[model samples]
Target: MSPIANAFSIDVEDWFQVSAFAPYIDRAHWHSLPCRVERNVDLLLGMLAEQEASATFFTLGWIAERYPMLVRRIVDAGHELASHGYEHHRASDQTPAEFRADLVKARDILEQTGGCPVIGYRAPSFSIGAGNLWAHDVLLETGHRYSSSVYPVVHDHYGMPDAPRFPWRTGDGLLEIPVTTVRWGGRNWPIGGGGYFRLLPYNVSAWGLRRVNAVDQRPAIVYFHPWEFDPEQPRVDSANAKTRFRHYLNLHRTEPRIRRLLREFRWQRVDQAFSDELEKACAS
Candidate 1:
């Protein structure tokens, strides 16, 4: 039997732009900060090339505008280029018009810069939840084909705990491929990626993902950021202790662990890994 091919993705944003540091790092100052995303993403690209793996990159339009060559490099390497909004704003925080404009701007920039049609999106911080289900309608209207913007686990930051654990189509025919989670103790536990991938022991995260494939028989979606690979990135001194801990903890170990994950499991771009589900969504 073939191994379950899981989706591996990267959220392409810099160190200072993380939502946790929003209060401390003003958006106005973002241009003044030292940008490490290019180098970090290059490092990831090299690693993926060595491992013979491919991934979908949910890149910020802000980054793509400033670094078109980086965007081209991702496309040239056979990865999907999708949006993470224009400025990393939360979908729930924006009006429908604002959300629509953001997606349009992002898709336009990504498609122009990468020379590929942008059809997938992952909201900044996974910000699309029950309150902003209208965001899905905007996505379909804006020409996006799928989204990995919802997480089913309950969390302090963002999640819709009641949402389905795997790929499901919205009323507008846009497929919502949520980040992977495992059902345990009568609730969904986050097992896919982001800081959880760092906080949990590598074996524990692996165990959860293995269970999702072995038992649930579904493709798992795992995500991380270019910033997570840069432990030497500048720090936000004013960030609270908990925020600081969550962002910086285990940064040095991220590369090795992700390399291990790439070797241990079959991985592919989200579009390819879940093509059948996405096709069904379009057909329906």
Candidate 2:
């Protein structure tokens, strides 16, 4: 394992909330889908506990309302509980007003349910980009101290290729931690986890993260969804070929990959991982 400790975070939403299925699954019909997040979260808890690793759960307000016990369990497990928005709406898709409303509602619900201040916010789909920097001001106004919303890559769906690669104070004064990447070929490559972690070979993923930690001498922020850990989750058949491939490719491999990830990296909660930055943000 590397000497640097990385931020391990979970985007706590079910498979149905994935943007790939947004076109097919009506948000209104979300309640009807068989909920698998609780089970998956339990699995994550067990894994983290076994390794004595801590992580942040960027959970949906909707999930906290429906699963207060689960939210409390996350906090009680000594993990950080943060917001992933109220309805899982993308920041890029929402107007500033809408984003503020969602931010406030989600943070409040998470704080109330978890009995802890929810200070971090990760946009749905890593949707905060050049088009929505205003969302950062809105997040600050709504009481979020930091965000892990920008993915520094050139992706078809979501990324800001020009964004800062490490945790930095945004112009808005909120600490903005873009997802981790390895700078090679004069370009930032995605290695921060999520679908990329599942799609890439385990050795490559481990090597990239190790390079980021030991060579760069910086902590990489690693993230994934709870649903990724649950290969048996109900599949959505209506997604297009590209979406299907991006979301479902190697679901069976994700769990073992995560197990390896835990053993290889020194992982800690997002908020705790950036505790100094957080305190500085609060003071300034």
Candidate 3:
């Protein structure tokens, strides 16, 4: 049997731009905060280089406009540069017009900065839900070939429990590749990365990926924020306790955990790792 190749993705935003910090830190003050994204992303680049791995980075246009060279560096390193919306607004918070405009602006900025046609997207904070399924059409119309915006697990902020845990096609023929989750205990548990990677034990996280690879017989998609590796980053004090814990817990350990994960499994960019699955999905 062949090894289970996984899709490793990175969401390229700084510490202050996390969706959980939105309520506490207004967008107007974003420029005033210390920018730590470039440093952390550079760290990710070195780590991936050491492992000989490629990844997909869903980047914000706001970041690209300020650091165009950084976006170019990601492309130079042979990673897929995908859009993460322009201003980091959730689909649920925006009208269809707003979402469409965001998509165009983001795709244009990413393509211009990275010098490659942006082929994928990841909605800010996985915000695509029943109320905003209209965003799917806007995505296809905007020319994205795929999206990794759906998290099948149930979460307080975003999820679609009935959604497929694997890759599937939207009604309009756009491939909707959901973030990884494992079916267990009559619920979809998040195994994709992000808070779950920090909150759970590393062995547990590894086990879930292994199970998804072994039992589900499908490639698991794992994603993390570049900020996860930066434990020295300044903290935001105004967020609620739940949000703070979710964002800050186990930060110092994230880099080592990532190194271990890379050594333990085979991973590549979303398009490369799941090409077969995506081809089958789109054809149907």
Evaluate all candidate structures by whole-model CA lDDT and list the values in order.
0.92, 0.90, 0.90
lDDT by residue (tens digit), candidate 2, 113-229? 999998899999999998888988998888889999988899988899988898878776899988889999999989989888988898877888899888888888989999886
> What lDDT is obtained when candidate 3 is compared to the true structure?
0.90
- Which tens-of-lDDT digit does each residue in 29-128 have in candidate 3? 9999999999999999998999898999999999999999999899999999999999899888998898999999999989888889898999989999
TM-score of 3: 0.97
Which number leads on lDDT?
1
Ranking by TM-score: 1, 2, 3
For candidate 2, list the clashing residue pairs, or say none. none
- TM-score (C-alpha) between model 1 and the true structure: 0.98
Candidate 1 structure quality by residue, lDDT tens digits, 1-284: 22889999999999988988988998999999999999999998998898788999999999999999999999999998989999999898899999999999988999999999999999998999988999999999999999999999888989999999989999879999999898999999888988999999999889989998999998889999998868899988788999999999999999999989988988899999999998898887
Clash number by candidate, in order: 0, 0, 0
* Model 1 regions lying over 4 Å from their true place: none
